[model samples]
Target chain A: MTHLVSIENVDMRYGGASGTLAVAGLTFKVDKGEFAAVVGPSGCGKSTLMRLVTGLHIPQAGHVIVAGQHVTEPVSIVGMAFQNPSMLPWRTTLDNILLPLEIVERHRKRLRAHKAEYVEKAEHLLDVVGLKGFGSKYPWQLSGGMQQRANLCRALIHEPQLLMLDEPFGALDAFTREELWCVIRDLHAAQDVTIVLVTHDLREAVFLADKVLVMSARPGRVLREHRVPFARPRDLEITYDKAFNDVVHQLHGEIASARRAA
Target chain B: MSAVIEDIQKSEPARPLIARIDWVRASPWLYTIALFAIWEASVRFFDLPYTVLPAPSRIFAAFYQYWSPIWKNSLQTLYTTTLGFLMAVVGGLALGLFIGWSKVIYAGLYPLMIGFNAVPKVAVVPILVIWFGIGAIPAMLTAFLISFFPIVVNVATGLATIEPETEDVLRALGARKLDIMLKVGIPRSMPYFFGSLKVAITLAFVGSVVSETVASNYGLGNLMSSAQSQFNVPLVFAGLLALAVEGIVMYSIMAWVERRMTGWAHRSTMSH
Candidate 1:
């Protein structure tokens, strides 16, 4: 089976020739419709990896291929969400969600003709995230968690084949984060889109991903790749299992050592 | 914020008639009324000469007597200021977008703009009169020249402040430079644009008045200057009062527009 995303022997250096080497010799693959998570210590270039895959940065020494084509320019089939939702303060929740549709080509061309249909779709997505009746409200009217959910809806609105999330839940409270994890889990099952989540939360990774990859400190490389043995339709009860804690603890030990090594 | 507003609305049915008046919001008007009353009383008690300081009653009398000329000149001043301000909005938006679009343009044009803005606009009036040959043209151009700088600077600042992460999100979705600018940059700059309008409107009035004083035979500035020459001190004070009233009205309108256009920004920042 062809992986939806493949980064082969990728090396990324920030600044010029003499600057910091952010990531080196990194290789990873996520199968089509699979969910994968990358966890690492801070400054381990996990974000650099996201940039490489999203074609925001061309890898120095290797190639990144998505949907069987090399990423020379920004790949159009990717959707991204960052830590800060960063919704435009001017737009209503529904309008903000519809933003990508106005920019991406196929939808942009069809937008005026199908604006009501798009609004229906956006409102439906908002409902899915428990944001029904909030379509008319502006971003500032919503709480932080609500704004993040709106941001997620904005990212997913175009229904890109691949979704890249960089610490999307980092700013949320633990309970809200877990609530979003369930939302994301249901979204993954329903949408069947390939997802690559870059986060520092071990439980978040284990609870949602099919596979979890841990990286070493600066100039990051994949230190370990573990297949999560959880079944589909996971519940919060799974997190309390001894097996889950063991896996998290093991990964935590690995990251601690990686930090010391750096 | 909405919750509090809703609570007030819900409880309004039970409030007494006098208590229902939004006194907190009306405080500015009340304070102005009280200040004028005190000034009228003090002038009457002190028996001050009108030349040193006109009493509020004398100022009102002058206003009544010169209503026709004051009305015509006030209209002229308003027309010139509004026309100049509108031109500035258009010119400044284009110039600001041009300057803010790239670091190269920003670096190249910013210093030149600063130098131009630093040159006192009053000194530029005689030069404007020489080029445009007096009348309302010089006044209008001066207002345009004075007000355009703030709008340009503010819009540029707004456009230049797109968060890096936000740019990345758009880029990863295959948005081009122009796409990012139209979708994100312009809308983001609106709050700043509206804010600049408040400052620029005031400056436009200053420019119009300054040009009128030196170059024009119409407008409140010229009327005041001519009145000063005749030593019609109360009429001069009335002209000053008319100008102040005009300024307040225009400023309030701009403030209302700003609140309407960019209410979300203020709401979020001020939210508990």
Candidate 2:
């Protein structure tokens, strides 16, 4: 299988007033249609790594290449979701989902004349995300879990080849989080898009991702990449499986080690 | 949990057919009546001099009696104020976006803008009168000077305060700089724009009035000045009342338009 996204020798540093690097010496890659998750303690630059692959931040050193192209600026072929979801309050759930289509080029020219067709597509996505009959409802009218579901749909609406999740389920409750893990699981299973998730939940990482990448604190580095030997079309019950728990326990210990080393 | 419970417990605050309204339901006329009762009583008991202040009843009569003159002067003032305000809106939005969009422009022009805005605009009334020679030009210039700052300040501040994640979302979608400006920058700034318009239109009225006070002899400002000289305080009070009403009317119109434009933003915030 070919790599859909690649980050090579990437170093990102946010300059402090006293002159210091924030996160340094990071490198990673996601193969086509793979669900990859990065797990670490907070401020470990997991988000920085996500930004790098999503073309939101340019690396100070090395390269970020996606689909055989170097990312000097932002690339439109990627979709992104964050912990906050941050849907524009002014727009309806359906309109928010179409936000990228209004911005990216190929979709822009088609938006006006084919608006109804695109709107139907957005409706279908909302339905798949368990938000059917909610396309016209405003963002403020939805619960946090529902809003995050809409956010997931919005990220997927443009159907980008690469999907980036920056702790996308961080704020939800345990139940809702697991529920969304299934939603995301199904989303990726159906779309087969490459997913890069930055997460703190070891169970979540193990349960959803094809491979899990562990990162150290501060100057984040890819300390380990564990390929899940578990079978896919993973049901929620798989989270309770001994093998699944074993992988989660193994990743958890690796993160504890990474934190102490940092 | 509490929120969900609250939603359930308070669900039937009103009946079902009303389409699930939560915040406000009573007719605003109740508040209006309360205000008027207080005003009517205060004037009756205070025994205020008619020259200094008139009773609501007297003001009502004045409202009716001077209707034609008031209307005429208002037309004149409106002409000046609207032209000036339009100019301000155009100039301010353009300058604000240009300054906001570029770091160099922001660095070069922002401080100077602050400095210019800080000067007391009323001082320019005399200079405007002297330069433009009254009638409508001076009044329009004064209105322009007064109304332009809020728009510039609000628009610049709005552009400056864009949410970082939204920018990130747009970037991954490969939005060009201009696309961000039109989609994100402009729409995000609209609340600021509408907020400024509320004050700007009022200032436009004030600017026109100041111009009338300094130079024009036929506007509402001039009519009030003449009424003051003749000790016809009721008419002066009436003029002020008329001005206030006009300001409210214009503000309401602008507000309605803003509500329509920013309905999306408003809806999202309300849910949270």
Candidate 3:
């Protein structure tokens, strides 16, 4: 199987020489078109890993390769969403989604000449995220869940090869979070894009990912990797299935132990 | 959800043009009239000398008696204030962007800016007078000097406070610094820029009046200073009243412009 993203024996540290080690000798590979989730105890550098893969920060040691290219600077083929859903309050929903297009050189040059076409593409992504007809509304006008949905649409608008979600649903209420899970599930299935989701919620990891990787506490490295054997097009009902709960419970236990080991 | 949209719309119902009295709109006028009435009553009952504290009637009569000079000085003050404020808008915006462009510049310039802002601008008027000589030029320069700091501070603040997550979203896509500024930084700072105008305009008026009181041959400040020497207390009050009216009008205009340009920033119901 072809690997879309690979982080090999990486070490990341913040500040200067006396800085804290966030991750060390960390390694993971995500296959093309796979849904991968990284779950760990709090402050285990899950967010640092996401940053490394996206080329926003270079690992102090070792390699982070995405789409077979070494990440030396920020790569242009990734899309990212964070927990805050930090939508620009000034831009309308559709305009917000189109923001990336105005930045990525491939689209930025053509966006003005082909404005309507790009706008249509953005509107379609919004529609798929269950936010149809709300494109013209400002972000503040929407509920938190709706703003997150717009955030997701913005991440997808550029048709990125890899999608990185950093606790995207962490701020939502339980019902809204589950609803967004289905939204993401449908999006992954429809777009055929590789996804790397970093989350703390074990059930979220089990329900959404094709493979779940658990990491140790601070100065983290992958402690274990578990393949989710569930079939494609999994339903929310499967979350209550005994086998599904077993996987979640197992991951929970691994994380609990990791926290204890810290 | 549709319910949220409905809630927003329902909260802001359209009012008829000839609806019953809007208490909020009428309050300022009612309070002002009441204040004047109380002042008039107090002056009459206490038999206070008009020279010490002029009655509203005497101030109005002085306003009519010296209408020509009052109008001319008022125009002069307005001219200097508006011109100085416009220069501040342009200069402050440029300097703010330059300061906000990098961490090094922000760190290097911030202390200097704070120190400059700390010195009383009234002191600067004399230095301006020495350089440019007395009159509207010194007054205008003082106005510009006094008003630009708030704009610089506010605009830089707006730029500096951009969410890191928002910046990351663009950086992941290989956005250049200019692209980030155009798409995010400049637009994000617009509300701050416009909001500062109201404050800067008011400060600009103070600046011009101070300079005028010190050096200028014209302006309401000069008129009031001259009237005080003559013991024409009512005329001095007339000049004060004219300055207050001009200040209110200018502030209102800035407020209206802010609402028109950056309405997106005011998301709270209280803003309405």
Candidate 4:
């Protein structure tokens, strides 16, 4: 299996030399087209790792290679969503989704000449996320769940090879979160893309990810890796299965110990 | 979902527009008329001297008597104020964008701008007269100087406050600094820019009148000063009335422009 993203012995610190260390000697690899989840204690550097891989921050030590190139600057091949939807109030849903095409150089040059095609593409993504006919509405007009659905469409509009989600569903209620989990599952099944999800929910990790990596607290590094043996197209009903509960419980124990060790 | 939709519907006005009384819109005119009525009644009951406080009726009579000079001076004041305000709009926007573009420029220039704004613009009029030598130029320059500060401050604030997450979304796509400014920063600053215009227009009127009083040969300010020296108190009151009308008209125009340009910034309730 070929790896699309590889981080080796990475060390990242905020501020300068005397600054707080966020991650130390962190190493991981995500296979091409795989759904990988990183879970740990609350203060663990899962978000820091996301930033490092996306080239938003440079590690003080070691390497981050993505798509066969060193990530020294912000890379163009990745799509990112965060806990906050943070949609621009001035833009409609379709315009917001088309923002990346207006910025990414490959699409920007051709965006004007082929405007209709891009609009069609954006509309299609909105439909897939169950936001059909909502393209003209301003973001503030939408509910929280609907805005997040639009955010997901915006992330996927550029058809990026790698999707980085930093607690995308962390702010949703339990039912809404579960509904989105199915949306993400279907999206993953349909798209030929690699995903790296940073989440705190162990069941979410066990259900949506092909592999789960557990990390230690604060100056975080991967402590253990677990392969999810569940079959694809897994149902939410499996969450009640004893075997699924066992895996979630085992990961829960690992996180509890990791927090205590801090 | 049905409950949320119902709540939104409940919040909306159910009555037709013509059937409802818009008290908020009518209150200003009502209050102004009531104030004039009270002033007129008190003046007549007391048999007050016209020089001390002319009745609104006497003021209007004087307005009819001196309509020619009053109309000319009013036009002059309006012209100087408008010219000065247009200059401020262009200059303030450029300076604001320049200052907000980088931290170094913002730090270096902000204190100086605050200091310059602190000095009384009325005091600057005499200096302006010394340089420009008593005409519309002094009045115009004073208007420009006095009115530009609010625009600069508001525009800079708008640019400075772009959400960090929004910027990250753009930067992660390999967007350059110019791209970020064009795509988000400028549009984000628009509501602030329009809001400042209403304030700046009123201040521009103040600047023009103050400079005209001390340094110019024309404008309502000069006419009022001359009328006062001759004890033509009704004419002076007429000049005040003209200034008041001009001020209200200019302010209303600015407010209308603000709404037209940046309606997106206002919520539906506020917009209505």
List clash counts for every candidate, in order.
Answer: 0, 3, 0, 0
State residue B64's C-alpha deviation in candidate 4, in Å: 2.3
Lowest-lDDT window of 10 residues in candidate 4 chain A? Answer: A138-147
Higher TM-score: candidate 1 or 2? 1
Q: Reference contacts recovered by each candidate, as fractions?
A: 0.78, 0.90, 0.90, 0.57
Runs off by more than 4 Å, candidate 2: A16-19, A110-123, B1-68
RMSD (Å) of each candidate, 1 decimal: 4.1, 6.4, 5.3, 5.6
Clashing pairs in 4: none
Model 4 residue runs over 4 Å out of place are B1-22, B42-48, B268-272
Comparing chain B with the reference, what is the TM-score for each candidate?
0.90, 0.83, 0.90, 0.89
Model 4: interface root-mean-square deviation in Å:
2.1
Candidate 1, residues A7-36, lDDT tens digits: the string is 889889989899899999998899999999
- Report the C-alpha lDDT of model 3 over A150-189, residue by residue, as the tens digit: 9999999889999999999999999999999999999999
- For each candidate, what's the DockQ? 0.66, 0.53, 0.65, 0.48
**TM (B chain), model 4:** 0.89
How much is the lDDT of residue B44 in candidate 1? 86
Clash-forming residue pairs, model 1: none
Native contacts recovered by candidate 1, as a share? 0.78
Residue by residue across B231-255, what tens digits does model 3's lDDT show?
9999999999999999999999999
Candidate 3 wrong stretches, greater than 4 Å:
B1-20, B268-272
Tens digit of lDDT per residue, candidate 1, span B1-272?
Answer: 23212345556587765575566766777788898899999988998899888988899999999999999999999999999999999999999999989999999999999999999999999888778898899899989999999999999999999998889998988898999999899888988999999999999999999999998999999999999999999999999888888888998999999999888778878874
Query: Cα deviation in Å at residue A102, candidate 4?
Result: 1.1
Docking class of 3: medium
> Which number leads on DockQ?
1
